[model samples]
Target: MALEHAILVSLLEQPGSGYELARRFERSIGRFWTATHQQIYRVLKRMEADGWVVGRDVGQDGRPDKRSYEVSAAGRETLTEWLREPVQPEAVRHDLAVKIRGAAFDDAAGRARLVDEVRRYRAGHEETLARYLAGERRDFPAGGDLDTGQRLQHVVLRGGIAYERMLLDWLDDVLETLLKGLP
Candidate 1:
């Protein structure tokens, strides 16, 4: 999906200024889709110009006035139309997989470097999994009922959690092979 769609969904969840939207993306939406603040600001401008979103300046104390944006009727229509379209499968682009394959031709020192890189990558995935688990606990707390939107969001977060777990498991296999047959 395009960043525009992600922004629309975010604004639909809660109207907010660009800064606030960026913060939300960093905290939650960034788990699936990522965008820099500058990119968000630029898109907000275009979306406003396209009449997909409306922005209003809000007064602030000790700070410049901020323009808060909310999805316009056209934006909702666009999102609805986009949602009905078929989703194509995404292509995998895994650099670590390439590195692991390339290690087959490397010297002992080079293979060791590959192992170190894999360990570093595994560490990052472990941290992400921890964060996902923490977020699930903080957000869901109980297995109680959730609204449709919340349920869907929770499912998506669960997918991320499962993906991280799978990656970690696969990395362990890779690590074992790498260490066992070290050059």
Candidate 2:
């Protein structure tokens, strides 16, 4: 999916300045779609030019005025059309998976390197899983009080948590097989 759609969804959730949107991407949206601050700004400009989003300048007491953006009617239409399109499964592009297979040709030292890398990767996933769990606890403390959007967002976060756990488990399996010299 394009970054545009992600931005639209985020704005719909709550209209905010470019800076605010970037922070949201860093905190929540980054789990599913990642874009740098520069990218976000660039897209916002394009989206505004296309008349898909409208921006308003808001004055601040101690800072420069920030332009807050919201979805225009055209933007909502575009988003709805995109939603109706079928989503294809994402293509896998895992460099570590390729490296794991390449380890078959490496000597003892290279194998050791692979093990270390696997451990590092697993550590990252563990951290992400922890973050997802914390977010779930903080955001959804009560089960029945959530609105439809909140419930959907929580479910997506749960999917992310599950995916990270699955990757961690698979990495453990890979580490065991590699260390044991199993074919």
Candidate 3:
């Protein structure tokens, strides 16, 4: 999906300034779709020019005015049309998986290097899993009432948590197998 679609979904959830939207991407939307602050601002401008989004300048007491954006009717229609399109299964592109297979031709030292790399990769996933869990706790606390949008967001976060966990488990297996081959 294009970055425009992601931005549209986010704005539909809540209208906000470009800075606020970038922060939201860092906190939440970045999990699935990532975009830089520049990208967000650039897209907002294009979306505004296309009549897909409307922006208004809001003046702050101390700071310069910031333009807040909300989806226009055309944007809503675009999003709906995109949603109705059939989704294709995502293609998997795993460099580590390829490296693991190629390691079969390497000597013990090369395999050891791969083992180290696997450990580092696994550590990254472990950190991500921990972060996802912490976010779930903070955002969807037990016994707390959630609005419809929040509930939907929580479910998506849960999916991300599950994905991270699955990656961690698989990485563990990869590390274990690699360790067996090392001296």
Candidate 4:
């Protein structure tokens, strides 16, 4: 998906200034698609020019006015069209998988180094899993009256949680393999 699409979805969720939108991307949307602050601002400009988004100046006390953007009717149409398109399978490019395969060509010492790398990688995944679980608890609490959008968002978050859990399990297997036959 293009950055415009991501921006459209974000704006639909809630209208916000560029800075606010960038922060949302860093916090929640970053889990799926990442965008730098500058990139977001640039896209917002293009989207506004395309008449897909409307921006208005929001004044603040003791601060500069910020341009808040919201989806225009054209933007909703564009998003709907895009949403109806067939989704192609995403290409996977895993550096760690490549490195693990490359280990077969390396010396025992090199393999030993890779083992430590795997351990460190495992630690990072563990932390990510913990964070996902915490977010699930906080954002998607057990017995709440959720509207359709909230329910959909919770499902997506659940998918992220599941993905992280799977990654942690695979990383554990990688660690075990890396440790085997090591002197």
Candidate 5:
């Protein structure tokens, strides 16, 4: 359901073919919302059928015809309704956290591995947050009035940064606990 709205929002930003939409998803919202090319294409078709978007055949010189999708008035109304609604909090689901909770059942070496994995995940998340911050700084700057789409992106990036910082702090606490127990 959120994916459908995401597709509509992407089309509202600008008209694009399914392939282009997939690429934009990877570059922009992939930090939080992930969708495969096939999934994006499928959602686009459904959106077109539902009258949320209209696709036009775009022919390029010496290239296959591509269908570019744009948001309709209906889509704008639907998106506005969605924006006005209360947002639901996402459920937390971390497989590593689950594994770490069960680390007592593992050997010493296994526990060490879990700690290492946690550290690696923290580093990767930090990198991702850095990228988001860089993109936001480049695009929106500090005191600029952003469009609806840019505002959404900014909110997502802020969330990413907060999440990463929390994870890093948690990792430090865990590592300290583990080190204290070492012989």
Candidate 6:
């Protein structure tokens, strides 16, 4: 999906300045769709030029005037259209997998180091996922009546949890294989 679509979807959630949108992406969308602050701002500008979103200047005391962007009707239509389209399988580009594949050429010590790195990475990701879950549970209680926005946020959170779990499982399998001396 184009970064523009992600920006438009974010704007649809609520009107926000570029800075606010960047924060939102880091907190929520960044789990699945990674984008830099510069990329987000650039996409926001392009989205405005394309008539997918409208920006209004809001001046606050002492701070610089912020341009808040909201998704336009056209943007909503575009998002809906994209959602209905079939998804293609995403290409895999895992660095750890590449390292594991190349471990055959290395001596035993080098292979052991690569396995250690993978273990560290897995532990870090697991901790991050735990944090994400804790925050979600705190923000939205299970039995609460969630509005559309809350529901959407929950869906994204679910995706993050599943992805993290898959990564953890993959890491375990890789660790087992490496320990067994199978290239």
Ordered by TM-score, highest first, the candidates read: 2, 1, 4, 6, 3, 5
Collision pairs in model 3? none
Among residues 3 or more apart in sequence or in different chains, the pairs in candidate 5 whose N, CA or C atoms overlap within 3 Å are: none
**Model 1 error, position 74 (Å):** 1.0
TM value for model 2: 0.93
**How many Å off is the CA of 134 in candidate 4?**
1.5
C-alpha lDDT of residue 32 in model 6: 62
Candidate 5 residue lDDT tens string, 1-183: 689888887777778999998898888767667899999888888888999999999999998889998999998898999989999897677787788778878878888887788788878878877887788789889899888868877887788778778877888898777655554
Instruction: Name the regions of candidate 1 deviating beyond 4 angstroms.
Output: none
**lDDT (CA) per prediction:** 0.93, 0.92, 0.91, 0.89, 0.83, 0.85
What tens digits encode model 2's per-residue C-alpha lDDT throughout 58-90?
999999999999999999999999999999687
Best lDDT among the predictions, by candidate number: 1
Which is superior by lDDT, 2 or 5?
Answer: 2
Error of 1 at 163 (Å): 0.6
Model 6, which residues run further than 4 Å from truth?
A: none
Tens-digit lDDT track for model 4 on 28-131? 88878889999999989999999999999989999999999999999999999999989868768789999999998998899999988988988887887788
- The TM-scores, one per candidate, come to 0.93, 0.93, 0.88, 0.92, 0.85, 0.88
lDDT computed for candidate 6: 0.85
> Residue 115 lDDT in model 6?
83
Better of 3 and 4 by TM-score: 4
Model 5: residues with Cα > 4 Å off, grouped in runs: 61-65, 143-152
Model 4, 132: alpha-carbon shift in Å?
1.7
Over 1-183, each residue of candidate 1 has an lDDT whose tens digit, in order, gives 489999999999899999998999998899778888999999999999999999999999999999999999999999999999898686678899998899989888898888899999999999999999999998887877899999999999999999999999999999999998774
Candidate with the larger TM-score of 1 and 6? 1
TM-score of 6: 0.88
Lowest summed lDDT across 10 adjacent residues in model 5 is found at 174-183
